[model samples]
Target: MNRLSTNIFRRSDALKSKPDTSAKQPFRVRTGFLILILSASISLANAEPQNQKNEILAELNAAATRVETVKASLQVGIPHPTAALVQWTEALVAYRKNPEFLYLKGYQPLVPLYFLLKSDSDAFSLFVPRVYKVFRGKNKIFDTSIDIDIALIPQDIILALKPLRINDTDHTEWKLAKDQTAFELTVKDKEGKILRKIIIDSSEHVRYQVEYNDAGFPYLEIWKDDWRDTGSIFFPYEIKMKRSLPKKNELVLKFKEIRPNEKLEEKLFQDTFPKDAEVVELKESSG
Candidate 1:
């Protein structure tokens, strides 16, 4: 009986020892696994500290290239209107509200224009600067109160704009028939009226498309949207503007001369309003 009791006690001790051994093995394995996981997470967290500066600079370089290509192509097709130019001018007269476009076929469309004078029919234009000079008859003349877009403004303005972003690849368009490089942009107003569409010829940025609303602001504009040079210099040479939405009217322009680096007198930038001309500056919208 004593021997039997001793055997029973030893068996109980063996069973308890088995459980402690198993528990210790599992605990050690768990601790090792946790350490490995923590190390991996810490290494991954500190990988790249750059603020995407390299990526942004690369994009800027590409954009500058696109603009440069346009500037170089400005002088290629000049000395009067090409076949495309004639068609563009014809479209303007047939759809133009000003009627002056009818006899001005020889003159290229610089920028769309309309009178905002309170005394006049309350017209407005795109945010583009106005031109006091025009190609009249056989001579380049100054037409006072004449709604025009000066070349200097368009050339300089295109460069000054901060490149907002590359448009989604989807909405982008090209007129391969006229020139493969021309790119067109179209934006709309809250009323669903076509607000703006402009085309820029990539081959020659000088040629561009500046669509005009009935009010004469570009509803769409395009000029040299691609194949830009490494620099940001640009000019609109061949332009086409289509009035889309409520009405359908289209105007195209061909530049006889597009000088990107033209030397301009500082006085040109100032408001040289005539003494008799009634000039009232419109305050910016509070909204």
Candidate 2:
């Protein structure tokens, strides 16, 4: 009887020491693992486009902040209803609304024209400086108030990217498209209208841009080439511009020298017309 009790106690101890083979895992373990993997894949895919857009915006902001003012030589070709008048001259083309003046001297009588675009109004005004007897009455012929269609503000590549960086990001939308050879970015408004379309090659810099009108039609196009870096800024030495409305015209501006961020006075941007000269206001439409 004593031997039988000892064998039974040993058997009971052996049963307690055995592993719990009957227990089961949680119900959703496998499913949770699969969902986690899918979420990670989606996050990686979405991050690519966002990264590309941020890179482009950063580049644009860097270019815009490099200069406060610009002075260059511009050759403008003005197309009349009948003939085209081509003029090559030097200009102080301010980038930050400091003041812009075009000095035309290739003609028999020199005419110095100043350009002012009022942000308060939807129009841009042109005025000539009040000339004294030095012009020999030749200044009167050019002393006229000319207003052209305000469809698009005529700007170079550097000035053109200013609004994109400064304005509210919610008002802007960026879309990317790519082909086998090149890539393009279309910047749109809140209403899904294309404001500007930029094209790039392998270098990934802006090579060309087409600006649109309110009706979503291409109004002006700019092409930039021969980029030069002036320590503080990088700008294109050769710029070509073409317009599609009002009067068909083309301008090729070659910068023989570019002066960036020159200190200018506040009085420069104000109207500098002579008080005695008769002011004639002329209005032209974008049509």
Candidate 3:
């Protein structure tokens, strides 16, 4: 016999004393029972961890629901490492309802600029008075989809509380920092690649910092500080964002006042352009 036929005959010979076909039903039934027991054991093992995760999430959601809105007057500074010039501007920042609306009006020396981040549309609009230009798109003044500006405009405790992916924790990993001062949560993609990391202090029960990769070699770092109680929730009054694109530049925000749950007008969120403004619709990139 050929090698393939000989190998098959050897396997058949090894099973020559197999249980009688008439009694094979018992063996099949027993094998199936064992599989069912193993499946149940694995399912129970998974359910317990899921329940623990849900409890932790519930506590965070409760704390985040306290604040409905936040408005602040911001003094922003942008420093240039290569040059001695440190540009400064003032802006009025307002955000309402998580993942809803964000508004900003920058009072630049040359001309005032207005920006609106509308999460419902997954886009942002910028109105420049100097050139009377209105620019709107996914990739403009700031990235739209990831909604990173949410970390800046309102910079609320809700952000730390919001879970990125609730249904699947397969790619989510969290642990206490080595120093034991803060807890860090790392989110990954399906391919097991790291997406971002969120770090919060358990003692303060608030997010202290966030680190993530941007369009640069070194990672981006954001720090929240100058916290004050607003009756409903404790919020950060000042935020510092630093980036290294071969050279380092930083954006510092100092809030003079922050009013939580403040009432704002509907017209404030509209994207009404000036009569002389040139509207620019950014073309979708092929990439």
Model 2 lowest lDDT segment of ten: 133-142
TM-score leaderboard ranking: 3, 2, 1
Query: How does residue 222 of candidate 3 score in lDDT?
Result: 63
Instruction: Give the number of the best model, judged by TM-score.
Output: 3
The sequence of per-residue lDDT tens digits that candidate 2 reaches over residues 218-268 is 877878777777667777777767766434546666666776677645565
Clashes of 1: 39
- Compared with the true structure, model 3 gives a TM-score of 0.59
Candidate 3 wrongly placed segments (more than 4 Å):
1-59, 81-85, 108-120, 139-172, 188-195, 205-220, 243-250, 284-287
After superposing all C-alphas onto the true structure, candidate 3 shows an RMSD in angstroms of 17.7
**Residue-level lDDT tens digits of model 3 in 13-63:** 555566555256545555766687688766654443343445555554565
The global Cα lDDT (0 to 1) of model 1 is 0.33
Work out the TM-score per prediction. Answer: 0.28, 0.56, 0.59
Highest lDDT model number: 3
Q: Per model, how many backbone clashes are there?
A: 39, 1, 0
* Stretch of 10 with least lDDT, candidate 1: 93-102
| lDDT digits (tens) for residues 1-287 of candidate 1 | 46645755565556566875865654555566567667765654533423432353345345444432111112112212234433222111111112111111122356333211111022211122244322212111111122432222221122222222323232322223233233344434444455444443333233344434556454444443333233334333444433332323334344443323223333423333344443333332243
Evaluate residue 172 in candidate 1 and report its C-alpha lDDT on the 0 to 100 scale.
Answer: 25
Rank the models by lDDT, top first.
3, 2, 1
How far off is model 1, as Cα RMSD? 21.5
Stretches of model 2 off by over 4 angstroms after superposition: 1-51, 73-86, 97-123, 128-182, 284-287
